[model samples]
Target: MTESLTIVRDDLTGAATRGLIAAHLAGMLANTPVESVHALDLTELQHPSVRVYSAWVGGEIAAVGAFKTFDTDRAELKSMRVADAFLGRGWGRAMLGHLEREARDAGIRSLWLETGSGPDFVAARRLYESAGFSYCPPFGDYSLDPLSVFMTRDLDPASESAGR
Candidate 1:
């Protein structure tokens, strides 16, 4: 099947975007405990530094991702999810690349993220690893927990070509 991908700064005030995120978070939190997904609701997704992106395929939302800036040179990946039908079809990779590019454009030199250390999150960990992230100590409000894992990748301008 042919799919078109576009990444844009999302405005959560829109009902469609809110519905998409709500459904994604609800699904993620359904099987896993609330603490596992740790996803932000619509209100929290509106933080000043968070830039959300939605991937649309033929006018339907295919996936979603966000970059939450923590400082001038650092940011965190949050709320990344691909619709069930689109998983494993390279949508996740495309979204990650888009977020990385957005971070670079914003002058961020590093990106970090936290994911659950459960079977449900294994694929996500592998995805981040394949995208150049390496295991790292927890950052921001996170602390080491048996149920959590943290990863980070440096976004050096000189290494941009090699990364791609």
Candidate 2:
């Protein structure tokens, strides 16, 4: 079935978003060590610098993603997740594309993110790679760590909007 997906800027404090954020966090905790689990909790997701997005299909959350601004041109991709029911259905990719467009709209020149370096994160890593993100050194407050894999992409506002 072809369902139209709606993307919205989510206020992570609400009940609908809170549940999804918690589920994403729980999945992160279950798969990685406490120290290596970098997924933001509900409170952190409420930070002023972060902007969260959710993809809704048929009135249900199919996927979610967020980005945190850093300086004027950089941002960190955060809290990306696809609901259990939406896995293998390209919802994650759709959510990611939405986030990228948002970043481009905001004049963000570079986008970076950190993900787990384990077998469980293989698919996530591939998703980033396919979306034009390349390996990079950790940014923001992150330090050199064996458990984290960092990736980045540079966006040009002029090029992205030229065709549109």
Candidate 3:
């Protein structure tokens, strides 16, 4: 099953991809306050600084993930979601790994992310933690928010703790 999962850069023009992003945003809004919802919408994901990717299993979109590059060596993970029909099959972790590799190859030395702090985000937080992300202060234009959890990880290949 894993071999069939092909992840590719998305142009954000497909109906399935757009629908999945919408669902991701809706889920974020439903689980967290509007002010704390940081999931990028379709237009935002298409920004020049942002790169979106979609994982396809067979003909259906299994998951979507993206990152927004900051200054030179930093990027923020955004819009990560596994389709409801594809959850619990390790697709989320696969997508996370895919994004990490893409960022690293693009010269990104640090990967940051913000997710909800409520129960709804436990799995997401855990997935990040297991992938070497550690809790950190908010980065970029973000600030401290009780409903948000900020995390970051070094992507430098020479760093001993790149993924630990």
Candidate 4:
């Protein structure tokens, strides 16, 4: 498909954008216990380390994703979701590419993420794996937990030999 989507920093002041994100998250966690999901709410998105992006297709919000820095050299992938209507239309992949670009721009050397091991998160885990993220020990405030699976991908552009 032609790349007709635009991904840019989210406009938190826009009610529609915020609503879309909240709806997506709510749908994603509808069946799981709140404690099992690690996604942040609107208030947490305002943190200094978090950079949120929204994807627009035909001027309508189609997807959203964020990168939250855990340290100078590391960041966590968070809140990645594409509206149901936009699924299989490449929005998720585009948003992911944008997050990686943002990570690189911020000089982040590694990207970490935590997703559930349940059926609800199967697609998410596959996406991360396809994007080159591999299983890793928990990082940041997270600890090893049977309910969670952590993954990480290193971004060392200077190391040309490193696989993308």
Q: What TM-score would every model get versus the actual structure?
A: 0.90, 0.93, 0.94, 0.91
Deviating ranges (above 4 Å) for candidate 3: 1-3, 158-164
- Ranked candidates (TM-score, high to low): 3, 2, 4, 1
Any idea what lDDT model 4 has? 0.83
Total clashing residue pairs per candidate?
A: 0, 0, 0, 0
List the lowest-lDDT window of 10 residues for candidate 2: 155-164
lDDT comparing candidate 3 with the true structure: 0.90
C-alpha root-mean-square deviation, each candidate: 2.0, 2.3, 2.2, 2.5
lDDT at 154 for candidate 1? 92
- Which lDDT value does model 2 have at 112? 97
* CA shift of 33, model 2, Å: 0.9
Worst lDDT 10-window in candidate 3? 155-164
lDDT (Cα atoms) of all candidates against the true structure: 0.83, 0.87, 0.90, 0.83
Off by over 4 Å in 2: 160-164
lDDT string, candidate 4, 1-164, tens digits: 77589888985777757977798679757956777778888889888879999888887888889999987888999989888778888778778877887788789888899988888788889988988889989888998778799999988656431123
- What are the clashing pairs of model 1? none
Q: Write the per-residue lDDT of candidate 1 for residues 55-104, one digit (tens) a residue.
A: 88876777889988999999999889888777878888888888888899
* Error at 53, model 3, angstroms: 0.2
Better of 1 and 2 by TM-score: 2
